[model samples]
Target chain A: MPGVLVIAEVADGKVLPVAFELLGAARALSAEGAGPVSALVPGQAHAQELIARGADVVYVAPESLAGQMYDAWLPAVDAALQQSGADIVLLGQTASLGRDLGPALAFAHRTAIAPEVTALKLENGRLRVTRPCYGGNARAEHTFAGQLQIASAKPKTFDALEPDASRTGEVKTIDAVGQSRITVLSVEKVESEGVRLEDADVVVAGGRGLGDPSAFAMLEELAKLLRGAVGASRAACDLGWYPPSSQVGLTGKTVSPTLYIAVAISGASQHMAGMSGSKNIVAINKDPEANMVKAAKYAVIDDYRKVLPAFIEEVRKLKAQG
Target chain B: MNIIVCVKQIPDPETPASSFRVDEAAKKVVPAQGIPPVVNPYDPQATEAALRLKEAAGGGKVTVISLGPESARDAIKHALAMGADEGILLNDPGFEGIDNFQTAVALAKAIEKVGQYDLILMGRAAADWDMGVVPMGVATLLGIPCVSIAKAIERVDGKVRVTRVLDDGFQTVEAPLPAVVSVSNEFGEPRYPQLRQIMLAAKKTVQVWNAADLGLSADQLGEANRWLKLEALYVPKVESKVEIIEADSPEEKARILAQKLRADKLI
Candidate 1:
């Protein structure tokens, strides 16, 4: 049986959390002694970090694979699969690059690919993957019969293992292959003002109950003070108070952090689907019976008008003191 | 320059939870009886963009292509009413449970069946899966350059200049003729069909092609090429506590709220 190959995505020389999450899930499957967990880290020299994260072997590309993610990435993934003779491959479901490259790679290799997988298990001598459908309202299970299979794992749905500092893995530098039709003419970077949302340890989200949509500023200020990201309920998004990208729900980004502060949200079940994984939840709302309060680790009953201003001011003062 | 815009009919997002059921044995959602499926929200943007191109191409053809159950004819009719010159519905039981890759394969075959076009336009992603995979998959299958998340596109001279939204902001990419561009909502709001156009659509012929007719079979449609397997589905579990702060004085409430915020480190 071939081993499992995981495509670990690196941007700006840093491996994304999704890469680790996929590896961890692959490790879980490999723990069954099904296969070894190999990784493909495409970059000038980012393969070492992948080896540290859980890979048994790392494939590093010496060229500037950073800019041409899909071009270098696809070949690296394909090469890893060919070398590992791997029957199964795992990748992060959230990457646009992943979504773009996955099907093409699968097609070229004549392999099967399951995407946005929330769960994976071995059943009846085959790999079984579970994915959500109908906007996270239902789950579907599929079993693969092919000797080779690939899957894109959804983030926050899998746990990345703790780093094994003592473990060392083999590294191989591979020659880049394929003439990519896609070319990167130039690259531009956008500067963010606050903590990167994906890297945030804490997050605070608000909903329509905040009265004025402008009240989101208060939540952002608080997030800034706490060194976190500001998120919004779908209700706020549908109401056009926030961009669709910032909407947190089953249809939006899935986030799991140490703390989630939900302000003036009623906690619609769909919205809860995204943030329920947070380690600790705090909700501040005027209505004591709001559904969000029921889901929070701590709930405060107060008008956001009275609560938010005070909260922002206090966080500002605390940061000043620090 | 003739263009084909592929569309899908999906269960409305606002459909009540109770009205939907999961057939775990089959790994599919059973839509409630009497419920209506709507054209995907993104396809209209693609349709609108295509119509504008048709207008600029000295009245070239704009065809709507859809693959779904027979009910998809209703979806195609909606497109016809929105200025599409014609509609083709590719419906077959074989396409059932097909993932993005399979769907793209069947769609590419359907496009081959249509046989003539310069550009293929699609929505960035469909609401049903939000996969955003089909357009890219189709492009790859056809060996064409694909640009997704296109917020704006205009024909300059003989080439297409496309403005696409990336992870951070946006970029302008120029590609020659016969390219695939997946449109975003920012392309423009789709125009409402006039009464005259709706009447014309009623009389227009909507050609339906089955998988067998298109020289495809169930063996190639679903699980056969499926590289990924689904394992399980369940409602996420959530539990929380809410506190309501009540103080007699405004200043007192503010002070207490401030203290609590500081304690939580949200401030």
Candidate 2:
């Protein structure tokens, strides 16, 4: 039985939560007779943390392998894959390293990969998956032609297992490196103020229909009052009405908050792709026929300018009463 | 500094969802009837990036390349209209139904045929498939460094310096000449072509090449040579069961909606 290997990703000196999600998915496949599960980490010894999350074995590459260049990091990754004997490999996302390294590995190894898989299943030692296609308007179901498979899952699609301090796993250090062709100058991680949009339970987003940048102030106030975060449609971000950091769309962040509020949004397919997974959706728009209004679980078909202030006041009154 | 920019043409992304259709049985997107395919949105920014790099280098050739049916020439022509020096269209029946990998292989061969370039540029992603796989794929085939989602690209100390957009922030990295860089929309708005430029571009050199021209064969192209098997493609059914809150007044509606949300424990 071929094993499953997860490329554990680290950001800000800690293994990303998505890496644990990969392990969670891998452990399930392992339980289904895919053999053991391994987490491949470079630059740091995250073995104990990963094992607690679900990895059966952790392969640690030398610190040098953590260098940002995709070419410079390929060799160690290849070695880890070989040593772990994993026929199926997984990454936490399609952005960052996954999009770069996933296709590179597939091309280098002369194999195929479905890099943005959102669903996965193991059948008779083959990996079957479904991925968003045609700009989130559709999904493509794919099955590998051979046993050696590579895929990267969309973030937030899988659950991360709880840490088990008693769980034990092996840590094997790999020795290999690749030729470096790129040099990093600086990495700036912009720490957002307050709750991060992706992690926020409630999100109040505006769109171009807001008509003016000042309208975002109302949204910010509402978000603050609700102790949530502010978001925006791509149109609003592109028009500079709000920061690009707050843009919610296929090209931006994938958010699945418990509650997502859309103000003056038309709910383009791309925008829907990002926040459609929210547990509840509320649309405030003047256009009764807007796609957002139709897709929303609850909709107010009136001018957001007229509706939002009163809505905020009502929420405040409701909170005060309770 | 010679630069190669790969462009593509696809159905307009702004085509309303109401008209967006996919044939489940055919496993294909039924092109929206009224919208003719336009140049992929990102490719112009790529062409603009290349044009700017050429201007900065004082003097160099900017060649635009596209791999698709003959209609793909519009993509090359769009880049040319934006002041690119020349265009190449890689078209062949063998190119049909090719996956990203095969597209990369054909493009790599075309780039090699185009010969000697300091840098290659492409849109961060094709707006249609939303697959940004080709740049890295081509880079791997050519054994060149690839920088993704570059908001800015400049030449410094004979290396390509890229300011990249991150999920939460930005990072700057430098790679040597002959590298591949995917230009993002953040690179700034691409310049629009004037009427004269469009006419001049129409008269500029537009080379049409087939698989044979690139030393490619039917055996090495299309579905037969693909690696990933597509089992199905269909538009997901979106059933809108929205509950419209009805009230005589806007304030009343707001209060009712808020109360409803509070009742549901959403707040």
TM-score of each: 0.87, 0.96
Predicted candidate 2 versus true structure: per-residue lDDT over B44-149, tens digit per residue: 9999999999999999999999999899888888889999998999999998877777889999999999998999999999987776889989998998888999
What lDDT is reached at residue B159 by model 2? 96
**What would the per-residue lDDT of candidate 2 be over residues A62-169, giving only the tens digit for each residue?**
765663666766787789888888899898664557767787788888777886677888877788888786667788887776557988866776778999999998
Candidate 1 Cα outliers beyond 4 Å, as residue runs: A69-72, A94-96, A154-157, A162-165, A186-188, A250-252, A268-270, A285-291, A310-322, B16-20, B32-35, B156-160, B174-177, B221-267
Top-DockQ candidate index? 2
**lDDT tens string, model 1, A188-229?**
445556776556788989898886789888888778777898
Question: Which docking band does candidate 2 fall into?
Answer: medium
The per-model DockQ list reads 0.45, 0.74
TM-score of chain A of each: 0.85, 0.92
Model 1 global lDDT (CA atoms, 0 to 1):
0.74
State residue A98's C-alpha deviation in candidate 1, in Å.
1.1
> Residue A109 deviation, candidate 1, in Å?
2.5
lDDT for model 2, please: 0.86
